[model samples]
Target: MRGLSLKMLKKITNPVLLRSDLLMVVLNRDSHWILVVLDLKAKQICIFDSIKNPAHKDVVFKLVEVLYQESESFQSFAISEWPVIYVELLPRQSSSSDCGVFVMKYMERLLDISDGEWSWRQYLNWQVEMNVFRAQIAYDIIKFGEQFAKEPAKDTKFCNI
Candidate 1:
């Protein structure tokens, strides 16, 4: 899995992403999906948990362990020096089922906002209006699928799953 992940990441041609200023991962914790944002710029591991009950330290340790095991490509990946900040005060899901959607929205908003002006203070109040955002994402995915159907996916596979 580690080698497959590294091989997949190597396909990225973007210089900024190769440097990986911010690495966002959606993790499945007991059927619940949560967002883990590694802010390499600040050297902080930020967890945006929709339930606001994240084991920040344990998650950080686990992340470091995974990175260490996968350290061949991630030569500079050292998490001990970085602090794990559980961002519980960010947008929260009203119910138990919206965690996956919340993670996607959180990543989308963060990437969109980061491209222009980004301030943690301003983003704290950034609400996840699920009704509209979910529909928008679905439509976008459908459009993307249509465009993707027009072209074939390149030979990007390294290992057969």
Candidate 2:
């Protein structure tokens, strides 16, 4: 995928993305959450949704095209040629209201696993009660806040709203 052509490298605006191995984006379509993961090393774009939707793949392709056009670093890559995979066998949300929680958990699990150890089938096998997951998320947030509050202010600056 490297040293393809000079013409393809003209529009790169973000160097950070070029260096990243994985890019994960969460999308909301009609209030339903969807996860799009761009695996640069694997040369594939994977879409994970609680409820399968084929139309979302097109949206991700369009987004990649826009990124290629706007960013010089992405111009060398051809997203149209790369395979787009729709992960079908994932742990689904039992209720529509849990889509956000599902997406968050998906991201958390993905990040927790090592690159070589990723397996969609084994990802979320454990039973996840939405209510329990929500409480855990809340607890994590509160714990983070408490730890952050304990740290002394550094280079403090105040601005009027």
Candidate 3:
């Protein structure tokens, strides 16, 4: 199926659809989660699969088609010509069940890197470092909500932690 159904967008309350930035998607195929990022600014779609396989090319293409359609429909932007780059050089999971975690970590590191600092090699050993990063994320969230928004505004409530 190409892009998400229009009904899907309607069901999403206060839909944050088309910001001028990379859009990340995490999808489950047969209970295995994988990551796909649409870089609108770069005109590229990057797929990060922890388990490398030829079948993932089909998944990537489908996602590209879907995103291209959705982008036009949602924001009047056409991304049909954007190239899809299969990132097969990511840190492969040693276990069968770490796909979701791998996707999340991939996203985290991707977002953390600055312009001109991106390299798949730098993110190696992520599986081994996952526990520490997980705890750190938990701590950061408990300290500050949603991108570390400091000082809740008057009439806004925050959970006491």
Candidate 4:
């Protein structure tokens, strides 16, 4: 860990959660979990949930795929949603004919809407500290708008575009 200090995050119970043109990662512990099929080049940590159905995959990102079960097929469900895993993330905008996708195991519950009364681990610790305090106030407003952009008089005449 480059200089460890008791870091956290680990224990991925089976992976794969595509759609959004594939790229949605959040497995920590000095991370590494890339999976891109049908090439869109490849980088990572891309999450664009356009207000819904991962916003219908920005209009069908190639017929999506995600539906796994079979590990004892979850003992026919309802065991208090035990070690929960029902699998679903398929066929976009979900369920016209219904498949209610799920792939939970040790979930960190999602689907939050301003956490009505907070309790899913205190709404996941205020959604991870309000997304690291809104990404440090959007990097201090883009470093104070590039150190206060307003320069053009040192003798003018500076064109190069």
Instruction: Score each candidate by Cα lDDT.
Output: 0.69, 0.73, 0.68, 0.26
Off by over 4 Å in 2: 1-14, 123-128, 152-161
Candidates 1 and 3 compared: the better one by lDDT is 1
TM-score of each: 0.75, 0.76, 0.69, 0.22
Candidate 1 yields a Cα-based lDDT of: 0.69
Least lDDT summed over 10 consecutive residues: which range in candidate 1? 117-126
Candidate 3 structure quality by residue, lDDT tens digits, 1-161? 43345445333221343454667878667777888887766767788888876567676676556654554453344556667787867888887887877887888888887884568886676778767877877887787785446665565322221
Residues 114-137, model 2: lDDT tens digits: 766667676554246777888999
On TM-score, who's better, 1 or 2? 2
Tell me the number of clashing residue pairs for each predicted model: 0, 5, 1, 4
Give the runs in model 3 whose Cα sits over 4 Å from its true position.
1-19, 69-71, 74-76, 137-161
Off by over 4 Å in 4: 1-47, 50-55, 58-126, 146-161
Residue pairs whose backbone atoms clash in candidate 1 = none
lDDT of 3 at 43: 66
Model 3 Cα shift for residue 91 (angstroms)? 1.7
> Which pairs clash inside model 2?
11-71, 11-72, 12-71, 12-72, 12-73
